[model samples]
Target chain A: MKIRPINHKKPSKIRELTYELKVEQVMCDDVITLSPDDTMNDVLRILRDNKIRGILVLDKDRLVGVVSIEDLISCLVDKGKLNEKIENRMTKDIVTVYSDESIVQVVNKFEDNGYGRFPVIDRDTKKLVGILTKGDIIDGLLEKLEIEYRQEEIHRYRASHIFEDVISDNSTLIMQYHIKGGDFKKAGEQTSKLRKNLLRLGIMPETIRRVAIASFEAEMNTVIYTPEGELIAKIQPDKITINTIDSGPGIPNIKQAMRQGYSTAPDWVRELGFGAGMGLPNIKNCSDEMKIKSKVGKGTDLQFIIYRRENET
Target chain B: MKLSRIIQILDAKILCNVQGRLDSDIPMICGSDLMSDVLAFIKSGALLLTGLTTIQVVYTAENAGVNVVCFVRGKKPSKETVDLANEKKITLLTTNMSMFESCGKLYNNGLIGGSDYEN
Candidate 1:
């Protein structure tokens, strides 16, 4: 096996784009706050009802300390003070981010302080306008990256259609196909198309084979499980990326699904020679990088990348 | 072992034309109907032997980097599976021998298991 050196000097475009966004754009403006004089019972109720980790404390329109679930739990265990005033037990030394500040600055503060969330306050009023968490920042970055990716895709599509052979050798090729559930007859169609495209692009046989297998497995998974799904393939100069997004009834246990021989496919699907539960593992094996994000009832998003070989022209 | 030699040893019937680069060597052999186990254990250029005759078997073989698929116990694949195998350029064969006897024959004929059983 050849060991490839890690490219540490390259900067991520997403991180650069996120640095240009303001905190106000991504912060949760609907702030859930508590008064300094509120009892611990109020904090517990608000945290549980809202499913939040912490609540901002306010005193006469001014942002005061913040009370986190940890503080409440510790107070409850150490003193059993459910009725005590929050001001007495809340964390007073709070770090905050201004709404006008760039997300990069907020990220820096998060890194330096190791805080899960930071209260977002207005510059002039110094009033708590929103709360920003690490999850919010990540979601914001992903959304931004997705928008940029889509815009680039649109440009590429127009360029390919309008200019034809004018497309440079370095230009990326993208293809998308929709797969319907219980579509056994058309299974592997998308992968075959992908394989043909890769071959046309002069990708190495070994790399093409891996991409074919990985994309086929992903395509089969969508056809077998989800009601409908989309498979998107992007061929770049240095790598190939495949993204599969499906609608409805996502995998409940991704970990178990990845295990060998673990199948939730009904007996009928199994009789069709699928649902041996190796789809995900096969995909992972063929791709250099794989990511799976799934919601129980919502949907699943799978993205994988295969790096091109050094000798491939 | 070469694919042609395997054909002679197992007395398998070639369901499709074994065209293109027939002299390519087969590194090892794996026998399993469970697609999951096949994907987990298979190596590139290996021969897959199973009794399962579904399109998924061909898909699994293609994805797992297995170039040849031989169905045991006289199992015949559907037209869809055969068409897919042809499209993927995967060689397909079927034999009347049971899975155990087929595997034993291959082992005795010097085709080792693809996975590391010694570890």
Candidate 2:
């Protein structure tokens, strides 16, 4: 790979990029909210129709509690609670994020609480302005990484004989490995290899650390969930990318899988000290870019990238 | 704090010798038996003190960048746990102190929790 010059002077640029990613920039402002008086039946229909897990319990424009599918499932067991008002069953202690808050802080909250989603309120007005999900943060990070990668590409192009070298010697180096499912013994093998390669290439310690965590999580996901999978690592001068493609019972609900604490692993897997449903979230947090696509009964493809030259401090 | 200092304060037994890693700096201590919670909040190079005595704890600690694990309340880990800890280069310790006391001692010794972000 053609290495690029490390920009030591603009060390704060990376931090500036992350801190500028406000909750509002990535939040879904057009939230599907339900009034407190709405019946559980109404909540059920909305959730089913939208393929969503939860609905915000709003009192007009004001923020309130959240009622989720778990609540509905428990209420269904009682049968008589079907017509009960959502306010009676909704969770009162709402955990929320402010629109102006940095994305890093939002990620910290997600890690600390293990919540699937959070209501985003205006800092000044204290009114519910949007809803932020793990998927939103992933998308935002992916966008930022893409922009940074493109800029790096431009720099590489300017620094070299662009078209001819691009055709003769591709700067990106690719390596692939096959991982078998239920192979807990060999779970982190590829991650260790990737880390070694990055270290040999002299990547920054912090960047290598994030890459190690992200690759390990993705590798474990494949080992725990799929029958078999291929892990692809691409090393570039400016970034390191890992792609996990698995063939197995695909995740039916990608949204749900992205949520923290949502795991489909068997109980025995939890005994292995995994399956807390933090794998994907942890991967997203460590990566500068992440994308996941899955088809029911088909397979899953997960891709994440970490910038090699990012500031450590 | 150093791992040696942690061992001294907790009156722990080293189950696995990690060579010079005992002299490595530990800025944080997280105590939890639930591997999920540990994975969620652990920082790099932090010390993990848990009551969980499974090989999975060692695996979790390895994945989360934790280099030292202390089993509290005198809980003994399996042979597989110690073996994995050795392979992964993670120092293993066993202490008779309760989880609360172990954490308190570390905190009293200036090893802080990893949650530095504002709540």
Candidate 3:
């Protein structure tokens, strides 16, 4: 019946506000509790069945502790003790909150207290009522953000959108990219940027994924093997294109490079631990359309395209 | 401990938004020296204390959405790093203790490691 002025919640339409206001208006009222004696199998099943991150451990009617997924993993992996009694390893120190707390206070409790999930208890009853998860918070936050984004779609400057500007209304543009050898440090920067731009343009998620995978591979190639190179990207309403042009010592044999198992990355690079040599093939695998043009002296250029579907195009 | 308490515990100097308004009561923590291992294993908002200070330290923290970074053992970051940390607005803390020692203190004082996200 009354509207309370709160902190700087973003201004939005009523519909937009509702999407972000994911916190339970009535306060979360469901939580799972565990007795220390609950077995590993029992707890595991609870986690699986309820799809909960953690459960509160209670001794009689009083809360004594908590158990989580990572705890179970440690018991199973390091100690080989999962089959043993669960009570012995269950945490005695449980982090929790009262149901009356504001959602912001609940969020603040997540970090200040240092636990990612908490048992929500009805203070008067001291009864575990529900679980609060960091994922839940993020889910709420993302909902708020996406709602905000949908209201006003805007484009920002980025290297990958170069194609977006050049492509004509009637024609689609596409390209592929290759990273020259010895450019490892700059790897993924291009594809990563491409991913950002696509999201900003409000492109379909799947289309962005395709361009991301292709560009990532090409960028890695330039860094791992090419002496000099640049990633080329093309954009069209019908399709998004990306190309990797490398002037490095070219792939001596196209067939060998295309082979899935063929890799030429150096040992030192691998030791720091990267470069499986599947870079090009992986890119090829991800693109809707792919082509490789390589010459021994001139180096390599890769072209890949992801077609935007007709209706959404 | 409240985040303010941690500031007291380590005699740590906080950079950016130390206006006695920061959240210090961390429910869980993950301590690792190798940045990648921490990135792969850590949950969305754990307090991270490590010995490394590469730019990827900020990068990993940003992606993981880690709220805090405690640079242990007299490790001072470059000015560029502080700028990055500031830009991201994530908490940056400095303490003069070895990784093992710092972690042990926090653990002994009751900080849980690992997250619950069971499903």
Candidate 4:
């Protein structure tokens, strides 16, 4: 096994790009679309020639369905005729994105649907205008970042102003993330974002890890026990404080909850290797200060703070 | 250890197509099915070995900054899990070896666990 040193300095522009860019700005407008009347043979040729996975099936400028490589393979394996109309094999239940929508929303769509690409539609005309792939988002962000880099003065201002706005006396950078219960797929996303923001801010890696782990436990608790919750982090110069507030069945006993090996998580959660009754204990262990406020049948507000002190760790 | 060498030792199959990633060195290893425990101990860019093949594993890897995840015991992830891992740029591998055997082999090959890793 060969071990390599970690690179703490990672490019932070992509995070900002997802938030700032739009689908139209990133999507490929020269879509290689096919008409529904087109045969599977045409799809095969276009996909192969274009080196693309999927092509939109359009009916007189209106998207009707989408055909992909999987569909093609299935057709071949099922011994279906190549001359068959693509409309027969194409999936009609297509999910699309409005051109004006932010890239972040498209990202969530990709994450939730697990689809390789999405057809971009114009809001007013409801016509397919472009196509978005995960690769497009990456290329678009990199392109934008490169342009921004060339405009060094604007880039510096944009990056530094975030800190300058919050680093003043008694000012705190507050970040909020919404947590949806039973949405296991989206859980821990907030913590990932928080970790990146902390890294971009040049926070100590040890401190950031502690902050992330503690918040992740809290985030998991919210996902496990609540119908919905919110994670709010207040980053100060000396400490980072996190509060996870949920309007769900609150903990009945704080003492028991804080104890190791005490969890009320369901069997399903345990099957995923969670609900070991270690969440609260892990949170308490990672943070310097911790507190919980709850009312039965009401909600729970869990808060923890990790101080940014080198001497402490 | 180099990810390629680790793959060779564990006899693992690459689950995702992420070019130029396998040649890099992996500094530490952390084996656990419990993601919360992983979050508690994982160092940045460490290789995670687990028997659990679920989307949450990728989520945990993303949150904890684990760049390489190898599923042991021939566990295979769902399409969603693989897609998410690819999007996050985390390498996914699957091995027929059990978690203990995978860890033992990696350890014998000089890959230290994250518990003993220090800056």
Over 4 Å off, model 4: A1-160, A165-168, A310-313
Better of 1 and 2 by DockQ: 1
Better of 2 and 4 by TM-score: 4
Q: Residue A285 of candidate 4: its Cα lDDT?
A: 88
Error of 3 at A261 (Å): 3.5
> How high is each candidate's TM-score?
0.57, 0.56, 0.41, 0.63
For residues B20-62, could you state the per-residue lDDT of candidate 4 as single tens digits? 5656789999999888788767888899999888777987887
Give one digit per residue, the lDDT tens place, for model 3 in A1-313: 1122323343433223333253454333576777888777777889999887677787788877788886788788876555555687677777777766655566555546667577777778876777677676556556666766765444433433544566655654344444445644444445655565566666776566556655655665677677768777776667777777778778788888877657787775544223455556666766688888888888887778778884543
For residues A1-313, what per-residue lDDT tens digits would candidate 4 score against the true structure? 1111112223335544665689999899998989999999998999999999999998986789989999999999999999999989999999999999988678778877777789999999988899998889878888998887777656445643565565556768889999999888887788878877777666777898788788888888898889999999998777999999999999898999888788788899988878988899889988999999999999999999999887421
Tell me the spans in candidate 3 whose CA falls farther than 4 Å from its real position: A1-185, A310-313, B1-119
Better of 2 and 4 by lDDT: 4
Native RMSD of candidate 4 (Å): 13.3
Error of 2 at A189 (Å): 2.6
Instruction: Give the C-alpha miss distance for residue B87 in model 2, angstroms.
Output: 3.6
TM-score of chain B of each: 0.93, 0.93, 0.86, 0.96
Which residue pairs of candidate 2 clash? none
